[model samples]
Target: MNENLFRPQFDALKLSDKLWLMQTLATRYHLTFKELYAFSRWGQSCTTGLFEKGGREFVFVPGNTVILGWEGFVQGMDKANQEELADIFAEIEYEGSVEGFLRQGMTPVRQVTIGPMFVGRKLEEIGWESVPMNDPRITAHPDWLDALRKLADRDGQSLKIHETVRFERNGDSWKAWLCHPMTYPEFQRSLLWDLAASLPTPDEWAYLCGGGCRTLFPWGDGMDYSMHLHHFESPEDEDKPFDMEEPNFFGVSIAYDPYMREVVKAEQFTTCGGDGGRGICGGLGIFLGFLPCSPHCKPKVQEDKELNGDYDFYRPIIRLENHD
Candidate 1:
């Protein structure tokens, strides 16, 4: 939120008024415009009548700091450039809306593209409904298994036996983890803020593992053992799952670990980018010269009963509408 005091009024706008102030600050920060059109001038071609309607793309982190396009794959801009690019966006001084800047906590950052559509299979084709909860084929109907066996007999050993369970469908209702015996970082950060209408902070996981390029790993500083990594060349490959490798410029594959994802800022909980080592659960580790997979490592700082298991996974960040 400290975008260097609005960088000289966003470097004195003009590129079509800075693309209409980045489509009016990405719809005042709820962000979801999949395509904004009108570029051309040397940037090749692209002209779809300057915004008529187009939602569900989510990743325009203009001033909440870096991760807009390109690395996330050409999200439009140019339109003949009138000037202004002073460090890519930062002027909208919070006038209201976007749920009042997410009730003052403010957040918007996305970028992790590289290849083989990874961030957990593009958060499962943009609907994110995992719920492996330790597998056993994941059944749940005898009245939700007798209400989870009376919530594991009224929370005995602090529940979370094995844990995995992810959800987020929203049409016929299937949102986050309905509570019951769910605990840890407050019901998995309130079931990932009710299954991703937004919730991926920790500075958007440090701008998607350093896309601002301070380098340590985000495709730099060397260490490309031929791409598709995993336990540094095979530490007894545990069946290797998750996006099968090759992604980083923001498509975000198994970024380096066997599991360790759970990110959020104001409501607390923290852990970021790095997996496939704590005994490999779902392979594909994006090499970063080893050691807690760089990009500023961050191995500890988890407490809400240590979030849960299967490497504590989590990934969802939608916002095509529904500000609830």
Candidate 2:
């Protein structure tokens, strides 16, 4: 009867209850304890009711308690980087040092118990249902192909529905290719609603990416320009692998592209991961552009409020009550 959750996900439960649910699901699915724990502290990921459709995978972020602020990392920061960050903050009109500005609400380095969570995986190639050109959803607009192509991959990668689908513009047998990305917003909503998963909170997100570690990026604080648009800027580099979104320690692709703003579940900012390329895209150079890769980076600006409604990069998470 001790059915209480420590963090609303796993407040509490008697040993029997934990064993019961784990045994029930694992036994029926032939899942081992390690596999069962996958949705939690271990295991890359295991499917559950969360994903109703599509191929977007999910991973388990185990509950943990650690200092979730910049205080623990400031001393190790290089003096020049500190100065650089401070300058960036000053340019943004923040009154204090770069560290002080970042510590605004991320301070106190208190102990936080993030219960085990199942997070949405941002894969390199998510399965999208291509839309047929002749589908009734198609309007009579001749420019639809060009405009939609803008949204698809430019070089024709995973999001490249525009590049792959062949159409003669005014051809008679005009039928479209894969599912339109325009449908992704509505489709993603329904999936989230059905799975009972919501976007990960900043802390939850930070942990998922960096595991609450002091490193800026989940891998390290170093900046790899090859991971940015700079890698793909040249004509000859067109076929090169952008090499973005490598799986993190948890095997979940959260966010890395500075241009692609990722949405998060937070009262403020409501956005994390990248800074919309304001740093590098703004001509500030790679150092600033790569800052958003830091799990702790705060890119909230005046217009960030609109991200939740329009942004496409977001990782949804479901809280499990049996977070042992």
Number of clashing residue pairs in every model? 18, 16
User: What is the per-residue lDDT of model 1 for residues 1-324, given as tens digits with 9 covering 90 to 100?
Assistant: 323113234334445654665565456544433443432221122221122122323333222234421121122223221112112112434344322322232123345422110122132122124454443444543444445556555552222232333333344333333223334456455655654344455554555444455333455433444444544456445455422243444434434553445444445556555433542332212321243444445534566644444455555453232222
**Structural similarity to truth (TM-score) of each candidate:** 0.27, 0.60
lDDT string for model 2 (5-53, tens) is 2223332444465456544533443334333222332222322222222
**Model 2: how large is the Cα RMSD against the reference?**
7.8
How far out, in Å, is residue 225 in model 2?
Answer: 5.4
Task: Provide the clash count, candidate 2.
Answer: 16
Model 2 CA deviation exceeding 4 Å by range: 1-54, 72-108, 123-130, 143-192, 221-244, 267-269, 299-311, 322-324
**Candidate number of the best lDDT:** 2
Candidate 1: Cα lDDT at 213: 50
